[model samples]
Target: MSISSRSDKKGGFRRVRFIILAISVFYLAFLQSSVMTFNTAYVVLSNETSSPLFNQYQLGATAALLNMNQFDWSPTYLPLALHRFPLDGLQRSFTFAASFAGGLLGTFPMLYVLKHVGAHVTMSIVGIASCILCALTPVTIAASFELFVGFLAAPIFPVIGTVIEDWAPMEEKGLFVAILSAHVELDTLFTPPVGSLIAEKVNWPTVFYVQALVCAFFTVGWMYFYRDDPGEHFMITRDEVDMIHRGKTKDHLMSPPYRAIFTSLSIWAVFISAIGTIFVGQFMDVFSPQYFTSVLGYSPTITGTLTIIPTIALLPLKAIAGIASDKITRISELAKLRIFNSLACFLGAAFFVVIILVPPSTNSAAATALIMMPFILLAFLSGGFHKAAVMISRQHSSFVYSIVHIFSMLALICSTFTIPLLTPEETFEQWRIVFIIFIAVLTISNIFFIIFVKAEPAEWAHVSNTNEFVQLTEEPRPKHQLRQ
Candidate 1:
């Protein structure tokens, strides 16, 4: 074929592959959304249940200790007899902590699974396991079992990082990561209200059953439709395969530079930023519904609906950040990342302050809107950071990203413990202190990220013995000479 014709064919194939991968990534996001929705709603459902298994006074006391504002010490009536599970403040904290622990435990195992089984198979296995666990949650009737399910689902996330690194073109990495990261907010958009309605009208158990069934269908779909590498996909045209082979780094499968990665300052900055981000994010996920119910006096349904506001606002901001990051790559990658990160943190911190200053008794609509503002603004920072991790070490992206995620899980565990300690009584006044702490952490982390984090690939990432970094400008090798 002529050079021009070949180039045209490659371009067409690249577009096709991009679309397929994007859709697949979005599907993965859906699975993630389902699991996170369950986690987010679990605490709310457990708290609303009036079971003899739990002590209302103990919960009251803990809430009082953590939240010094006026709280109703009276027990709520359970709509169903089966709804009697004891989930006092301390117990709730422990349950959330267990889930975080599970996620942390799955990190190393995810790396091994991704390398051996490949992203598609690994995601399929984890997806099915998590679905089964969700289906069984109502029957199991124990928080411990729920925690185990969280652990199983935890590895699914790191695998996504691997897939992105392996498949996404370098130029469009930000956009791809943005779409994947936005799934969390997307879940927040629909799942909270839907899950809440199920918990309210029918029962919490029904929510799990429905999620399980949906997950099962998707799990099978992924197995049949998705492939780790485009070259292996039956549906991909030869032209598409050639495009992928030409674009990807040869060193992708080589042994990772563990020593260099571990010692890198940029990696550490990403870790610290993740810690700050996840700490606040988990606090919202695990406790925001409780906050609306206990402090703002909203019903479960209203709380669920209200949670969607921040999520809706966040989605577009993440897309904007992602697009902007990709478009501004002519600037230093580090500069783009730092600019977004610092802006997000500063603006998010300001919003948090506004949330804190707004009294709970202010107009309910206004108060809720103010409370959601920080989450929406902060979403930009979270999305940008994910893209930054990809840029810093594309070959070892999964491992680096997983390390940050594992630490974030640790932060989640710590937040579960500390949140209750800070606002034992579930009062807006007590929650103010929590928001202030969030602002401080975000500010500090952003400052550190701006000062230290670099977006260039790590030295070790380019130093593999068997394979070398592929330059974007390098000439494509003869198809026969390409590694299959």
Candidate 2:
């Protein structure tokens, strides 16, 4: 065959590969939207268990100090008891310190397991272990230890992205990425309301039990259906596999160049922006109801019903922003995406800050109405900006997301603990300060993005040449320039 005919054949195969992967991704997306919510709601409910994973150690130590029985203490009792428990700083530090230490040590083992066993297998293991751990332990104790479980489970999404990249073609990359991220958005959006409903009728432990059953089902399904690569799956033809081999010159992904990747100002901006959204986002996840009850004086039922509105806004926003990004640039431009993301975050942050500044004595209905608008706005825009961030770094999605998420989550853990420490349990003022700081940091990140990021790949960049089946290292072009 002539060279041109061979090229045409390869292109045709690439298109076929893209379609198959897109179908798989959408299937996962639909499943994940339901499953992710169950998974997270279970974690939150587990936090109240006797041996909860993340906060269990802290609760255990405190219980030990107070000489209190886990069963006798209500959820309300523990917090009240802790307030009077004394040496507040030291106690809180121990909780955070132990969890952080465990996280650092646990990550190695987690990565090792994932690398050896693969994503589906490793996720199954963690899910099973966490469920058993929840069942055996008390609510308070379970809360403490669940943090470690969260850390261990962290790598699953990055692994999923890698699987998508290896098996999926260029045309479907954005949509697949959005599908994977949809798991996160759905988890955040739907889980809390579900948990609240459970908490209203039954005790919290049931949350984990239900979650455990669901995960067990998913584990079986995953093992049966999830092939790691296109080459392994029967649905992919040999012709398609060969084309993927040709198109992905950097076939086996390597560790990205840390220096160049990290030094990019856009990365810093993305990281800071993610953190900013996470602060407010955490409140929505963990404390929004507490805020509703304590600050706005709403009943749990009212809070539960109303709370879902912001997340409802987020779901469609995420889908629209992702589709828009894909439509605008066949290949993502970091500079353009960054600016758009920054603007969205900026608006979100501004609204959240305004809500925070309302005086402590504001009437409950008025406060709820005031904060609700900002909450919806921030949630929508935050979700939108986050999707764009993924698009812009399409080539390095897995590694970039992992690094950014690690830092963002660390900051998130710190913020979760700090807001309670700073504010009176019944007050909202301290949380306001958290939002202010979050907004300021993101604003600075946006400035860096505006000044330093470029619209195209850079000179020192590595380009995968579909036509040649090799990495093309060309002469240094102007900063942020891509070959035509």
The candidate maximizing lDDT is: 1
Candidate 1 deviant stretches above 4 angstroms: 1-14, 19-23, 33-95, 237-247, 293-300, 357-366, 463-484
Q: On residues 1-484, what C-alpha lDDT tens digit does candidate 1 reach at each position?
A: 1222222223323455565555565566557665555554565455633333344434576673454223332335533324535456777656656666767777787778777777778888888887878777664555576567657766655765776776666666777777777756665655566776676667667788777777777778778867766655555554655445454466666667788888888887888887888788876667888888998889976776776667777788887888788887477787888878876778878888888877878777787777777677766774457777877777788777778767876786788779989998888889999999999999998888878788777777653444433322355657654433
Q: Please give the range of 10 consecutive residues that has the lowest summed lDDT in model 1.
A: 1-10
Question: Candidate 2: how many backbone clashes?
Answer: 29
Candidate 2 Cα lDDT to native: 0.52
lDDT of 2 by residue, 163-277 (tens): 5556545544445455555555555543455544564466455654555555456555555555545555434444565545444434234445668877776556566666665
Misplaced by over 4 Å in model 2 are 1-105, 112-121, 131-148, 189-191, 195-204, 237-247, 329-335, 353-396, 425-432, 454-461, 464-484
Report how far residue 176 has shifted in candidate 2, in Å: 3.0
